[model samples]
Target chain A: MFEIRWHSRAGQGAVTGAKGLAEVVSTTGKFVQAFAFYGSAKRGAAMTAYNRVSDKRIINHEKFMSPEYVLIIDPALIHTADFTANAKENTKYIITSHLNKEDLVKSQPKLEGKEVYVVDCMSIAMDTIGRAIPNTPMLGALMKISGMYEIDFFKESMLNVLRKFPQKIIDANMAAIQRAYDEVN
Target chain B: MAEKIDLLETEVWDGNMAASQAMRQAQIDVVAAYPITPSTPVVENYGNFLANGYIDGEFVMVESEHAAMSGCIGASAAGGRVATATSSQGFALMVETLYQASGMRLPIVLNVVNRALAAPLNVNGDHSDMYLGRDSGWIQLNAYNAQDAYDLNLIAFKVAENHKVRLPVMIHQDGFMTSHTAEGVKTLQDEEAYAFVGDFKPMNAMLDFEKPATYGVQTEEDWHFEHKARQHNDLMTKVYPVMEEVFAEFEKKTGRKFDLVTNHRLDDAEVAIVAMGTTVDTAMMVADQLREKGIKAGVMGMRVIRPFPFAKIAEVLSNVKAVCCMDRSSPGGAPGMLYNEISGALYNSAKRPVVTGYVYGLGGRDMTVEYLKGIFADGLENAKAGKPTTPLQQFIGVRGPKLNFL
Candidate 1:
C-alpha cells in the first residue's frame, strides 16, 4: 500500500492533484481512494487531501495517519502546517518551492536525510500555464520522483481527465507538467 | 439469476457524483433541489447532466430545501419520476414536507448525505439528520461507500415506487465521507440500469385528468387515528417485502446482494457491534482485527435504518454476549437512537445480550482504528464480565468532557 498526503491552501487544487493521481493510478487496475479534509472552507485557509493506492482493496476510510509521501502544494504551509506529521524514516517529500534543496534543508534540518526535492512550481506554472496554480507541476514532480507512471503517460491521462476544461487551459496545464517533469530533481 | 453486469465502463466517482449518475440513469422526469454542502453536488451534477443533454429533465432550482421538496411533491404528484438531495440543515428545513411526501404516498427519492445538526455550524459527516428523519415516514436506506451510494439510489426508487410501498425514500450516506471521497464504481450500462429501475407507474397521480384525486387532505380527530395507523402499519409491514423483492431483482441483474441487515462473522461469535453508514465499515475492520487475536467478534451493519429491521436484528444478535451500538448522532442526553432501537429489538429475545450505547465521531471526526480497537477491547471486557465496563451510554472521541449519561 502507498499513501500520499497533500497540503495546500483552499484554491490551490491540491484535492484535484490527489484525485488526478488516484485516477491515473486506478487505470492500472489498482485500488485507489482519494479524499479531502477541511472545515468551513474559505479562499485561502489550510486544507489537506489524501490518496491511497494499493494492489489490495483499501477498507479504511479515515484520514491517512502514515503517509509514505507528502506533497506540499503551498510552500507557505510548510511553516504553518505540520507537513511531516507521522512521517516515517524513509518517507519522501516533494515540495513546491522557489528555493533549492540545500536551502530548504538549511531552513529545516529535520528534512536532511529523507529524500527532499524542491521545485519552483510557481515559476513553472507562470512560465507555462500563465497562472500560479502549482498542483499540476507538483504532480509532474511526483511523476519524476515516484516513477508510478511514465511522465508522458501520466500527462496524457491527466489531460484526458481534464477534457472538460477549455483547450487553452488543457494545453497550458500540459506544458506546466512537462516543464516541472523535466526540471525537478 | 445468473445474468451478470458487464462492466462496459467504470468511473471514479464520489457518492454524490455516483448518486447523480444513478438519477440520470433512472431517467427521472424532474429534480427540484436547493443546494446544501456535501449534498449540493448530487443535485448540481444532475443539473449539469440536464444542461449537457445527458438527461432530458426539468431541474428546478428552489430557494430553500423546504421549497425543493414542495416542488418535488408537485412534480411527483403530477405523475413524474422525481428526486432531490439535501443534508444537515437543509434536511432539517425540509422535515415538514417530508411527512407530507410520505403521507401523500408520492414516492420521491431523496439522496440524504448525512451530516450533523449544528449550532457551531459544521459541514461534516454524521447521522444526526438521518436520525431526525427516522420517524418522518420515509423509508430510510443507508450506504457505506460510494458504490452503495450509487446502487442504493437505484434500489430506493424501485422500492419506493412499489405499489404496496408508495412512500418517499431517503437513501443516506455519510456526508463528505462518502459524498466527497472518490473510489472506483462499476456502473451498469445506462439501458441496463433503466431496465432494472423499470418505468414509473404513477398511482393516483394528479395529472391523470380522467381520474381526479385529492392529496394532502386534512385528517381531523374523527379519521386521523386510522389514517396514521394505516400509513404507519403499512410502512412497517409492506416495505420489507417490497425491499426484499427489489433487492433480489437487483442482485439477479447486477450480482450485488443486499439484505435488510447485513451480518459479518456473527455465527459462533460472542461479541458484536451494530452500526450504520461509514461506521459499519470501520466496525467490520475492527472485528477482523479482533478475530486475528482469537476474539469472537462480529459486526452487524443496518442496510435498512427505517422499518427498523427489528426481527432480523434480534435474530442476528440474540446469541452475542455483548453488543455495542455505535451512534454517530448526538442523543442530547437520551440514550443514543440506535442503542434504544437495538435494545427495543432485543427486548423479548430468548437470549439477551449486554447492549451498550456509544456516541462517537460526531461532526466528521475520524473513527480511527485505534479508537475502534479501544471500543472492541472494552466490549470484550464487558462480554467476559457479562455487563458493561463503563456506563451504559457514553460519548467516545469527543473533546473536553467525557459525557456519560444513563
Candidate 2:
C-alpha cells in the first residue's frame, strides 16, 4: 500500500486531480480512496488531498498523516507550511516549481537525499493553456517518480473524465500532463 | 439554577454525558473527536469515559473536525462500530466526510446536536448546521426532548449497521434543549443494551484479522452503482418495515413507543403544521390553541426524517386540505430543503394536497409558543388562499427579517 499526499491551494484543482488519479488507477483493479482536508472553506486556502493505493483492499481511511510520497502542486506552500510533518524517512518528494533540481534542494535542505523530482509545471500549464492549473503537470511528475503506470494511460483518463470541459482546456491539460511525464527529473 | 443530580447505575452526569454514554452503550469501538462548543462537552465526556475505562475503544484526538470524521471513516471501515458527535459549523467541516462515509458504505453513527451556524457567531440551538448535509445519505432522526435523545441513540446504532440496511444514521436534537438539558434517561445495563441489540458484526470488515477482507476498495461502474442502488432501495423500501419492527422492539424493551411520525389531530383538520425537533412542542401548543379557536388546524411531529416517512405523510396529509411545513433550513436556490424533498415525495400522488413551506427558524431564533401562534396563523391564512404566509427560514422575533427569510 502506498499513501500519497497532495499539497496545494483550494482553487488549484489538487482535490480534483487526486480524485481523477484515483478514478484512473481504479481501472488497474486496485483499491484507492482520495480525499482532502480543507479549512476556511474558500478558494485559495491551503489544502491537502490524500490517496491510498493498495493492491489489496484498503481499510485505513484516515488521511495520510504519515505518507510515502508528497506531491506539491505549488512551490509557494513549501515556504509557508511544513510539508514534511507526516512524511516518512525515505519519502519521495515530487515538487512543481520553476527552479531546477539543485536550487530546489537547497531551498528545503530537509528534503536533500530523498527521492525528489522537480518540474516546471506552471510554465508547462501556462504555455499549454492560458492559466496556471498545474495539477495535470504534477500528475505527470508523479508518474515519473512512481513509474507505476504509463503516461498514456493517465493522459487518456484525464481526457475521458474531463470531457465535459472545453476542448482547449482538455487539450492543454493533456499537453501539460504529457510534458511533465517526459521532462521531470 | 442548581441542577438536579442522580446516580447509582452509570455515572452522575448531564445530557452531554448521556450522549457519550449512549455512544458507549452501543459499543462504539472507534471514536474521533475535536472539541468545540456544545459539542466539546460530549467529546470531553467521551475522553472521560475513555480515561475511566467506560468505553473500550480507540479515541483519535484529531486537530480539526475534518480529521475527526476522516479518522472515523478509517476506524469504521476497520470493522468497528465507530461514532462521533458535533454541532453547527463543526457539522459543516464534517460535510465532506459525511458524503464519503455514506458512499463508502460505512455504517457510522453521528449525534448532530443542533446549533446555530453563524455569521454573527452565536452558539445556540438551531438546525442550519446539519441542514447543509441533508442529502448526505444518512438516516436522519430528530429527538424532541432528552429521553428521545437517549432512546433514539440506541435505535440509531441498530438501524445504522443493520446488514439489510447498512446506512449511516444522524440523531439530531436541539443543542441546549437536549444536549445540556437534564432528563430521566433509562440506560440499560451494558449487558441489557448489548443483548437488546445483537453484537454489531460488520459485513466484510477491514479489521477482521482472522478472515481479512478488503474495505473501500475500488469497484467498476456496474458494481459500484449496484452497491449504491442496493443501499438506497434497502434503506428506502425494506427499511419501512424494519423501522417499525425496531421501534416495536425498543418499545417492548423500555415500555416506550415511538411512531415513525406522531400525528397531532389531522382527522378533520384543514390546515396541518409539520415540523421536527424541539419546535414540535411549540407547534403542538399553537396547534391546540388554533384548534380551540376553530382554525381547523393540527400539528405533526416528524421523528424519522430520512427514508422520511413520506408514505405516512401522504396518507395522513392527503386527506387534509392544505399542509404547512415549517422547515428550519433554507435550501439553496429554493425555499426549504426539507420542504422541497417532502414536496417531491408527495408530488406524484393523485390526491396531492396543497403544501406550503416556510423557512421558519435560522440561526436558532427562539421558536416560542407565541411565535408558533403567529406561524399557525400564517399557515392558516395561506391555506385559505393556497400560498405561503411567510419565508421558510427567517429568524423569528428578530427585526428586519434576518437574512430576509433567505
Candidate 3:
C-alpha cells in the first residue's frame, strides 16, 4: 500500500487533485481511495486531502495515515499544518514554495534533515493556467518526485480526467503540468 | 423512456454520486429533496441529470427536509416511484414523515448519509441520524462504501416495493467518510440496473380511483394495536424472505452476494468485533492483521440494520468467546445500540459470549486501526478471563479524561 496526504487551503483544489490521482491509479486495476476531512471550513481555511493506492482492495477508512508522500500545494500550510504527523521513516515531502529546498529548510528548521523537494506551483499555475489553483502543478511535481508514471502517460491520462473542460483550458493545464514537472527539484 | 446515461465498467464515484446515479438508472418517477451537506451531492446530481435530459423524472425543490419527505410520500401514495436524500438535521426534520411513509407502506427509497445531530453544529459522518430512524418502521440497509451505496439503492427499491413487504427503506452510508470519499465502484449498465429493479408496482395507490382505497386513516385504540402488530410481524417475517430473494437474484445478475449478516474469519475465531457501516470494513482489515499475530480475531458486520436480524446475529456470534459491539452513535447515558441489540440476541442462546460495548467515532471522530487493535486486544482479554477485563462500556478515541460507563 502507498499513501499520500495533501496540505492545502479548501479552495486550492486539493480534493480535486487527490481524486484525479486516484482516478489515474485506478485505471491500472489497483485499488485507490481519495478523501478529505471537511470541517465546515470556509474557502481559505487550511485543510487536508488524502490518497491511498494498494495492490489489493483498500479497506482502511481511518483519517490517520503514515503517508509515504506529503504534497503541500499551499506553501504557507507548511507552517500551519502538521505535514510531518504520522510520517513514515522515509516519507518524502514535495512542497510548493518560492524558495529552493535549502532556503525552505533554513526558514522552517523542522525540515532540517528531511527529504524535501520544492517547486513554485503557484507561479507555474498563474503563468500557465492564469489562476492560483496550484493543484495540477502540485501533481506534476509529485510525478517527478515519485516517478509513479511516465510524464507523457500521466499527462495523457490527466487529459481524459480533465476532458470535461474547454480545449483551451485543458491545453493550459497540460502546459502547467509540464512546466511544473520540469521546474520542481 | 428516459435517456440512458452511459457509465464506465468501473467509475470513480463518491458514495453520494453513486447513489444519485443509481436513482437515475432505476428511472425513478420523482425525486423530492431539500439537500444537506455530504448528501447535497446526491440530490444535486439527480437534479443535474433531470436538467441534462438523462432522466425523465420530476425534481421537486422543496422548502425543507420535512417538505422533501412529504413530497416523496405524496408522490409515492399517488402511484409513482419516489425517492430522496438527507443527512443529520435534515433527517431529524423528516422523522415524523418517516413513520408516516412506513406506516402507510409507501415504498419510498431514502438515501440517508449518516451524520451527527448538532448541538455544536457538525457536518461529519456519524450514526446519530441512522439510529434515530431505527424505530420508524423502515427497513434500513447499511452501505460500507461507494459500491454498496449504489448497489443497495437499487436493492432497497426492490425489497421495499415487494408486494409482500411494502415498507420504506433507508440506505445509510457514513457521511463524509463514504459520501465524500472517492473510490472506484463497479457499476451496472443503465438497462441492466433498471431491469433488475423492475418497474415500480403500486398497491392501494391513491391514484387508482377505481379501487377507492383510503390512506393515512386515523386508527383508534380498537385498530391501532393490530395495525402495529401486523406491521411489526410483516417486518420480522416478510422482509427477510423478500430480502434474501432480492439478494440472491442480485447476486445471480451481478455475482455480488449480500446477506443479512456478513462475517469475516469468524467460523473458527474466539474473539470478534461486530460493527456496522464503514467501520465493518475497517475492522475486517484489522482482524486480518490480528490473526497474523495469532489472536484468533474475526469480524461480523450488520448489512441489514432493521428488521434487526436477531437470529442471524445469534447464530454468527454463538461460537465466539467474546464480542465487541461497536456503536458509532452516542447512546445518551445508555449502552450503545449495537451492544444492546447483540446482547438481547444472545440472551436466549445456549452459548452466550462475553459481550462488551464500545462507543467510538462520534461526530466524525476518526477510528484508527490502532483504536480497533486495542478493542480487539480487550476482546481477547475478556475471552481469556471469561468476563470483561475492561469496563462494560467505554468511549474510544475521545480526548480528555477517559470515560467508562456501564
Candidate 2 residue spans exceeding 4 A from truth: A1-185, B1-15, B219-224, B292-295, B384-395, B401-406
What is the lDDT for B402 in model 1? 83
Q: Candidate 1, residues B357-403: lDDT per residue as tens digits?
A: 89988889888888788778778888999877878888888889787
Backbone clashes in model 3: 0
TM-score of 1: 0.97
lDDT of 3 by residue, A1-59 (tens): 99999999999999999999999998878899999989889999999999999999888
lDDT of every model, 2 decimals: 0.88, 0.74, 0.93
lDDT sort, best first: 3, 1, 2
The residue-by-residue lDDT of candidate 3 on B1-406, one tens digit each, is: 5688778888999999999999999989989999898799999999998888899889999999999999999999999899999999999999999999999999999999999999989999999999999999999999998999999999999999899999999999999899999999999999899999999888988899899888899999989999999999999999999999999999999898999999899888899999988899999999999889888999999999999999998998889999999999999988999999999999889878999999999999999999999999999999999998999899999999999987
> What DockQ does each prediction reach against the true complex?
0.67, 0.01, 0.89
Q: State which candidate, 2 or 3, has the greater lDDT.
A: 3
Second chain TM-score per prediction?
0.97, 0.88, 0.99
Q: What CA RMSD would you report for each candidate? A: 2.8, 22.9, 0.9
Q: What are the fnat scores of the candidates, in the order listed? A: 0.61, 0.00, 0.86
Off by over 4 Å in 1: B1-8
What C-alpha lDDT, on a 0 to 100 scale, does residue A137 get in candidate 2?
Answer: 87
Best by lDDT: 3
